[model samples]
Target: MAKANKKDDNVVARNRKANHDFFIEDTIECGLVLKGTEIKSVRAGHINLKDGFARIERGEVWLYNVHISPFKEGNIFNHDPLRPRKLLLKRREINKLEKNVQQAGHTLVPLKVYIKHGVAKVLIGIARGKKQHDKRQAIKEKTMKREAQRAMKI
Candidate 1:
């Protein structure tokens, strides 16, 4: 099935810093392997993707540092907040991503977590780290654009 677009409203969490710290080259949405309580927590918008990242390990993609808060009524069955989760992606895509990430300064980062058709999905990006100068330039451009827009409004 085709992946959902960026404008989808079901987004649960986003890693805003990823945009500022890395240049996203490509994006792939993969299904999540979640437990009962974990899904409940995610549906409740209790997920944090700020520190999350993806790794290709043993021919599979694994997600780390994605926090899914425990379900309030789960009692003893509440899921762990920081457990590593598996991501479902095709073998070909996985291989390509692995190859790209093996290069210097390239990494896999989780861009966002969203619900599509009632199923949880994560949008992972193949990204390259930005230099300090590049980040400063980006910030400068953003400020300039903002100032220009504000000047236009008056």
Candidate 2:
């Protein structure tokens, strides 16, 4: 008998503003240390990544400002919505991220949150803040691209 493979990589939430605000240079997928209720809330799509960022603290990566709403049934055992959560990554990968973040104008921004193979994960980007002019240029390019696609369709 052959084993059937299940579809993986269910995205729970995305930080749509991350790309608009920063130029993403690199991305890494890391696991999140979620409490019981937190994971339930995540599966229910009650998580927000909009204002989330990661910081290396004491040689470990910590995710901050990501909101995981309290579980409906978790009256007394619910975790704090804005609590800092630990991100799981190999030591070498953490070191590499630390080195990259030490460069000027670079920071770690959470791009999205997802559940892969029943485990919660976060996709973080090594990004640099974009200038006002750069943002305008990006918007212009996007509009041009959309117009071109529309012209081709017609």
Find the candidate with the highest lDDT and give its number.
Answer: 2
Candidate 1 structure quality by residue, lDDT tens digits, 1-154 = 9987768688988899999999999999999999879998898899998888999899999999998999999999987899899999999999999999999999999998899999999999999999999999999999999999999999
Clashing pairs in 2: none
Q: In candidate 2, what are the lDDT values of residues 48-125, reduced to their tens digit?
A: 999899999999999999999999999999999999999999999999999999999999999988888889999999
Clashes of each: 0, 0
TM-score of model number 1: 0.94
Clashing pairs in 1: none
lDDT of 2 at 1: 90
Off by over 4 Å in 1: 1-6
Least accurate stretch of 10 residues (summed lDDT) in model 2? 3-12
Model 2 residue 28 CA deviation (Å) reads 0.7
Model 1 RMSD, rounded to 1 decimal: 3.6
